[model samples]
Target: MTRALLSAALLLLLLPGAPAQVSSQTSFTIVVSNSVTNAGNKTFSTFVSFRGILLGGMRRLQDKDSGFTFKYTEDDNYGPFLESVNGLAGCPNHRTYWELKVKKPDNKVILPDVGIGCYIPSAGDVVILNFNKY
Candidate 1:
């Protein structure tokens, strides 16, 4: 096309994996601030879940709501994983665990919602999530 368009195309071709700033993820960790809490009639856990997509280790449900904060450590690979705290098999106090799932065009998946969270880790990459005990 024009000289300017040609130059732009050349520049784009020169760059490698321009879509991904760096490379595929290698390692990941989940930090749970608060796990569980008892309130009047309901016992609940605060959680943030996701895969591939980095999430917060700490997040406020609201500015005014008061909640407990707890922490946990996770050391797992980058595949399918479910991170969660034990709960009654059948309970209403338990909300459906929040989750984050990512499926590739190739039919591969990662992370989940419910417990603390999940990850598709990369080397030297850290994922943090914030939650309050309900």
Candidate 2:
């Protein structure tokens, strides 16, 4: 298991009196399209890292969970980013990284996942990463 190996690596480092180092998080060039359904109405442009972070863990949006935000959240030059895992069997409904909704002065962005709000992204709508693919 990847986790097991990581644990072992950490243990090995500790055993040798070496400092445990967190792996540098991965990077993404996430692009949100208008899905054609929105059809030229939504914004579809490439936004680089504007100080972002990935999120995951027990901080999942699940009722069955231990009510924890067990996810990995990262920050970079762009916006916050989070990787999500569904709460199915071993998968906890948690985000693996942080995906931020880039701030806007007067814009509305709708996340299909929760359908919670009609957000307005003025600074080129940074996606509030709720999408997951495992």
Best by TM-score: 1
lDDT of each: 0.36, 0.33
What is the lDDT for 106 in model 2? 45
lDDT of 1 at 7: 98
Which run of 10 residues does model 1 get worst, by summed lDDT?
Answer: 82-91
TM-score of 2: 0.20
TM-score for each prediction? 0.28, 0.20
lDDT of 1: 0.36
lDDT of 2 by residue, 1-134 (tens): 99999999998778747555655432322232222123222222232223322222112223333422223334454333333333211224542222233323244544433211222222344444333323
TM-score of 1: 0.28
Q: Write the per-residue lDDT of candidate 1 for residues 1-134, one digit (tens) a residue.
A: 69999999998889785344553333333332233342232232222333343323233222222442333346465432333322212123664332333334344554434433333334333233322222
Highest lDDT scorer = 1
Clash count per candidate = 22, 57
